[model samples]
Target: MDLNQRITAFSNLSLFLKNFLSDATKCEATLNDFEHLKEELQQVIQTANRHNAWFTPEHITQALSSWSAALQKDNLTTWLDAYAITSSSEKRVAVIMAGNLPLVGFHDFLSVLITGHHLVAKLSSDDQLLMPFLARVLIIIEPGFDSKITFTKEKLPQFDAVIATGSNNTARYFEYYFKNKPSIIRKNRNAVAVLTGNETPQQLEALGDDIFGYFGMGCRSVAKLYVPQNYDFDTFFQAMFKQQDVINHHKYANNYDYNKAVYLMSLFPVLDNGFMVLKEDTNFSSPISVVFYERYTDVETLKAELQSKADQIQCIVADDFSDEDVAFGQAQNPKLYDYADGVDTVAFLLKL
Candidate 1:
């Protein structure tokens, strides 16, 4: 199909979902009862369980909501536009999905889906289930998508745009391999926050979601904190402790086990036990799912530090850092205006 055809198809798909999301029939438990629009999510999550054999039903359900909300056209446009670039002609793109967090592939999926191009997907072994599950859903959404997206286990296919996500380690290889193509080669990034004096217990409680959601594995999740000098750590910890049960979950425990061993081997200092580790440094990313806290005397100092690591961090959580920074705990849950990596997506896409 041509770009126009693909765009028309995607627009239709998007409209269908917008309508379906509000439909009463979409609440059915059985995939068989789900109509075409809902079938993509329904089938994809079911197949995800089959392929991974690790993701629980709860994980599937959570991811389903994540993608569903993300693809809502009004909310998605900002993020979607980030990948929009005018294609010379017929375009094909290869996308590598990240499995570090659940439904991490959704961005790459949206990149390809909105671009009106064929997606040659290389699924992550850690997160192999989501893409395939999504493939089933997309095919259900638009049957012709079977030909648009190709799933592979071995080598990748040729393409115009390459979207790859990996650690700081594999980034060099991605740059070398896809250097010639128009690509968004994302390296590891961490999220941080600027603390104010007015935060209440309720506000700190919300921060727990930014900290523990997805076990702090996602790039969007918070990894560091910048609180005012003399800020009461007691109040912060008090509010965040409401999620103690989250720390007790089995999946979170597994991360605790693996990261703790590495911490032991390296003898790294910790801030807390069995939950999050902390430290202070120039580095933005931290291990063991810990959030590093730094003391800042004023907003200017915090702004200066945030500017230094702009490209390495995701969202800045503070009272209101203007239209740019996201609200704390809202990192994983973005509003319609929130764009990925702070890039304006819709304008990017329209220009493309």
Candidate 2:
């Protein structure tokens, strides 16, 4: 398929997702060819939830909604407009996906196929169902994709290049294993919110979404906070009450109980709101159900500190702080062009 054909296929996939996001039973009239896939997709969501406790239906729906918004024809066209993309020599590009969130490695999948390369993906056991199901939907939309995608459980076949996402330790292994090949190896990174003590209640509530979405399992999920000196915790905790139901999940509740017990036993001071805890900490990565925070005396100094540790941070959430920072609730709602780890997947694929 040509570039326009690829773009149109994805756009149709987005519409299919929209139909699924809307009530599947009611959407059959609108989703003609996609109608049969709706029930199967629902089954996959159920299987995903059963296979991985972290993959809640609500979280999976949120992921689907994000992708639905991203794959619009205009969004695809505008994002691709930046690159001088044409057909390239088709090479097999392998992607090592992470199972942190539902459909987490989909962007890499889309990147390989959209750039006219063959895809050989090893699905993470925790998230094995969603991507391949979507690939089936894509193939139905444009049969050309059938020859271009492969999902395997065995040792990955020989490929020209690879893209892998994992923790720092696995990154070292990937770096060594794919040493001779052109690759993008991603490591763990956390997002942080910078609070100036001037945020309105609305903004703080939105920030709650950034912090608690997906049970804070995603790299883009805000895991830490930077607050001005002597910043009061009252408004922030109040704003977070909207997401209090996150504690109802047994896994999250267990983590909260365990972490809270550890902190109390250690005699460490923490601000608790029944559902989540905020601890004064300098670290970027925080435990589930806990948000680490550090106080900053000045913006310039804080900026310098974050810049020095740039590779350790995935996203900075703030308002009018820096052009690069994501807005309060938008960290998880990244556009098609918001390349993870600041590496352009399409550009890398194009080079291959």
Candidate 3:
């Protein structure tokens, strides 16, 4: 498809989803629609069956709600930027996805669809089935999308760009592989949190959404807490403990065991939840339920610390948005305009 054709499709898609938005909101159908995501939900679970890809019915409900809300603009002028289909187009895009959470590949899908680009996606072994099923669903929803998108198994052919998400260690490998191309390479990223003294139980629940959703496998999931030195971790634990059924899932239990054993061998002090472990390491990505922490004197110091780790952190879930912080869980549920790596994918598509 030409750039014009691609943009037209995206524009139409925005409108179509927008129409469903109202229906979704009215009937709580968005949450209901997650059942639609379940048949293939196990694909990710199967991939993570050995790891921690437990997709609880509640999580699926939450994911669909988030996905619907994401279709609407929280505050973006364009849905995405069409970077690949410029005058000089990027022909074949090798996309590396993070299997940490379901639909972790949504940004990549938008990047490919809006840009009128071809994607050579290497499915994270931990998250293989959802994206393709979603693509098929979208193609059915809008027949126009069928001809433009295709998925592949082989290494990508030479192309204009490569968008890859990986650890800091693998970044060098991607750079060496795609040096001459226009690429957006994502390094190890963790989400952080700042706690104020007056958090309602509702906000605490939201924090649970951020941390435990997907069993803390997502980069957007909080792996560290910047609480006051005297803050009671017990309050947070009690709130998270409400997810007892979540704590019961076997897939998550497996990761919990693996992570706990590692910590035990390392002689690490960990906060225990029958199956999961919460630690105080500074690592951005946690294996299963283990997360890290640092005590902040106050919100101001916490914000400053977050800024210092800006490149490594995706978003900071703070009660206060002063100095430009985002809402809790917003990082995990990104609006369509929220581009990965600050790249305006839909706008690029529109201009094309």
Candidate 4:
């Protein structure tokens, strides 16, 4: 299929998702072709939490909503127009997806196929159902895509290029194994927020979305903070109370309990507000239910330090910290062009 065909198919997909998300049972007649798929998708969303507790219906809906907004024809066309995309000989691009969040690796999947390449995706066991289900919907929208996508359970088939997301250790293995192939090997990275004492309660509450979204499991989730010395915790904790319901999840509650107990057993000082813990640490990647924080004496000096450690940082959440800084609560809501780790997947795929 040509570029316009591809774009139209995906835009139709966006509408399908939006219709189901807005009201699953009352879809427009134009979506008659998607009627059965809509019912199936509802069941999938309903039971997703059973497959993976983190895939709560609310979070799954949030993911679908984000994609529905992102996959509009205008957004897809504008993003693709930035590059001189062409119908070159199709290359087999293998994608090893990470399942930290609902449809977390979809951007890569979209990058590969929208570039007119065949996709061989190894879905994470935790996210086995959603992507393939979406793929089926795409196939139904454009039968031309039927031969272009593959999901595997055993060994990955041969491919011209690869994009793999994983922990630091798995990244090392990917690097060595795919050394000869064109690849993007992603490692563990987390977001950090720079908080000034002057931030309004609204801003602090939005930051809670960055922290508690996805149960603090995604790479864009704020895992640490940089605050001024002697900053008071009273206001911060108060704003965070809005997200206290996150503790209702048994998995998250267990993590909070276990981590809190371990800190107490170790006799380490910790600030707790019932749901989340604030520990004074310099680490960027914090455990579930915990957020590490450090005091910064100067913004300029802190900027330099963070820049020096840029490889380990996925995003910086601040008002004006840097040109690439994601706004207060927008980390997980990246635009189509907001590539991961500052690496443009389309550009990389074009080169391949």
User: lDDT, candidate 3, residue 84?
Assistant: 37
Q: Model 4 segments beyond 4 Å from truth?
A: 24-29
Tens-digit lDDT string for candidate 4 (1-352): 9999999989988988888887756443255556687889989987777989989999999999999999999999999999999889999999999988999989998999999999999989999889999999889888999999999987999899999999999999999999999999999999999988988988898999999999989999999999999899899999999998999999999999999999999999999999999999988999999999999999999999999999999899998878888888898898998878889999999998
lDDT of 3 at 300: 61
Show model 3 residue runs off by greater than 4 Å: 1-65, 72-90, 261-267, 346-352
Where does model 1 exceed 4 Å of error? 1-56, 76-88, 254-270, 278-282, 335-339, 342-352
**lDDT scores for all predictions?**
0.66, 0.92, 0.64, 0.92
What are the per-residue Cα lDDT tens digits for candidate 2 across 18-79?
Answer: 87898655442244556568889999999999999999998999999999989999999999
- Candidates' RMSD to native: 4.4, 1.5, 5.3, 1.2
Give the alpha carbon lDDT tens digit for every residue of 225-319 in model 1. Answer: 88777876767777777767766666666766777677668877655644655555446676645678777787876787678878898787777
Better of 3 and 4 by lDDT: 4
How far off is residue 214 in model 3, in Å?
Answer: 0.9
The window of 10 residues in a row where model 3 has the poorest summed lDDT is 22-31
Which pairs, if any, clash in model 2?
none
